[model samples]
Target: MHDTEALQAKFFWFSPGDMTDVRQFFAPGRVNLIGEHIDYNGGHVFPAALTRGVSLWVRPRADGVVRFFSVDFPETIEARVDELEFRPSDGYANYTKGVIKAVQEEAGTLFCGGDFFYMSNLANGAGLSSSAAVEVVTAAAVRALMAYPLDNARIAVLSQRAENDFVGVNCGIMDQFAVAMGKAGHAIFLDCQTLAYEWVPVTLGDYALVITNTNERRGLADSKYNERRSECEAALRRIQEILPDIQNLTQISIDRWDDVETHLASEPNLLRRARHVVFEEHRTNEAVRVLKAGRLAAFGQLMNDSHVSLRDDYEVTGPALDALAEAAWSFSGCLGSRMTGAGFGGCTVSLVRRAAIPEFEEHVRVAYADKTGLQPSFYVSEIGDGVHEQQKEGLEV
Candidate 1:
């Protein structure tokens, strides 16, 4: 449970002299352990929901007016349930507004106004799925407030819809699914094509999943994400000329790759993209194997390989990202390090021994600062559960 006293103090600071009852809802941010850009290419993604994320203290209003306040933003927002439209000026609240519109489509008769006071420790635009966290939390809040019929998976789907149609970011289901279905101490092995998944126990015997944000903020909708996906699609189309049975880049094997090697060699860019997607899928499969076999070292090596492919072949890592991951490689305790997420510039997930985390952090901080002239931040992430509601009166999920 979160500290109730601190929450009450913060809540009072925002809305003083108010005695409205509220419920807290929380959704966890996520980190992709391996398997980067291939999520939409019909590949597998290994991700775990993190402990840090967005939280909301929401209470219904009889006036049917929606109001939003956040410690992170300067201004408070007010609107009607009927006027929930996307306004670029609204910033983070757009995710909330998007969710309201999405859920309203499902439960049209249950539209009601509410006040939402939000705060989060998650670093926005740092490749931690903060937007998805906000949308999922908002979806849960709406469901709880109206007593609507929706499960976490249903909420995740609607949240993805909000991002795609409402928020205008064409993100895949991995972020939403992991944030909605996450189980503590486990990483979800998800087939992006089929949406079939399983929880793999994350038994990192002596190492921890450390996140180092390069602080080079990136917005996915504005990044090269769509272009990268299109490249993979184009590559898939080219390969299908030779292997008529192939559906996605994932189905093309290393042998099949050899068969069509010359065809792809003519188009180096398409070849590189297809190679990364194919190898990344294999790496994800291998990663699951190593994790299940209790082999952390091998798992760490796959992380290294994944980053190399993303860097050299995929070409998504800018100088900031390259510096961060390269610096992590020099750290004593770090077994492996890779740039995670859409990865124009964001964070790197590193596997480091628990005892050496402080040294690891200081080393990367100094090295990254010296290289980029911008200081970076580090967080030792914990795998946590998906979105859940905190009952009335400060109960924890």
Candidate 2:
């Protein structure tokens, strides 16, 4: 919670004098606690939204023009509400425009255009989903401004639509869904294909969730993310030839895997990708079981296994990420560490005792830097609520 009066001074710094009716909203960035790269494969993903996120201060404009100003970036983006399109030079504002376009298309009419001033503390390219944060926060703010009866789930779907259709990124629903429906102190266990979810309470009493950024700055668009997706699609098609009834890789049970394995063995790369998806899905199910039983050590071990499968089978983790994970595993207090996100370069999520965090940070910092020659960043994260309107005295939208 924040003081509305104090936030007014900071949030509306770039506001025009005539703009009086302003409202504040927030959407959070998320970290995948255990599951990784399995979302689009119809597998389970366990992600929790973090307190670190983006904030928006918005007020409707009389002219049907959308103007965006961000404290995080230098350029100001302006456009007509009816003419939103993908522009490479617009930088971060493309996410903002994408959400607006998705919402307008959903509603079948143009609503009020507004001036949006926003800022965020999330690292832009650290694999903590800064793009999803921007898309979700923009969606929520636009929903409020238009007084649309859309729920948070719809907002999340629209945000995913914005990313896939408007921004040209074929992403799964986990990022946007977690950002829109996050709960404090809990992680959402989501079935990416079915979208069935349960809030699993995170009881890491003595353990702390730490994220280490490799600072290699890989964008999902230009990374091998799409190539991986294509590889999986190719594998799925080959498997379907063996068992015509199979719908997705998620349908492959342990008993069925041996039968499907022979079909995929010809293409080593596709075989590896398929193996990762199958095993990671089972790991996610076991994670929920161990987490609920308070078996932190078992859960930690699962995290380590997940990383090995990703590194060897999925082939996403590169040198920098490998070095960071290796460094954390060598540290005494670390229970588990693994590369997270699209994984050519990004962050690693590690679980360590709260008391050991200081020493753990110092050791991993020097060790990872020595191995990669790139200084990494660390964040001790807390789970937080999803996109919502801040409590304050103001006219709604």
Go through the candidates in order and give each one's C-alpha lDDT.
Answer: 0.87, 0.86
- In model 1, the clashing pairs are none
- Per-residue alpha-carbon lDDT of model 2 for 119-202, expressed as tens digits? 778887888888888888888988888878888888888999888988888998999999999999999999988889999999
Which regions of candidate 1 fall more than 4 Å away from where they truly are? 1-20, 219-221, 391-397
Instruction: List all candidate RMSDs to the true structure.
Output: 2.5, 2.8
Which tens-of-lDDT digit does each residue in 218-314 have in candidate 1?
Answer: 7543558888888988998999998889898988787777766788888999999988998899999999998899888898889989999998999
Q: List the residue pairs that clash in candidate 2.
A: none
* Per-prediction TM-score to the true structure, in the order listed: 0.93, 0.94
**Top candidate, metric TM-score:** 2
Q: Give the backbone clash total of model 1.
A: 0
Scored against the true structure, residue 147 in model 2 reaches a CA lDDT of 79
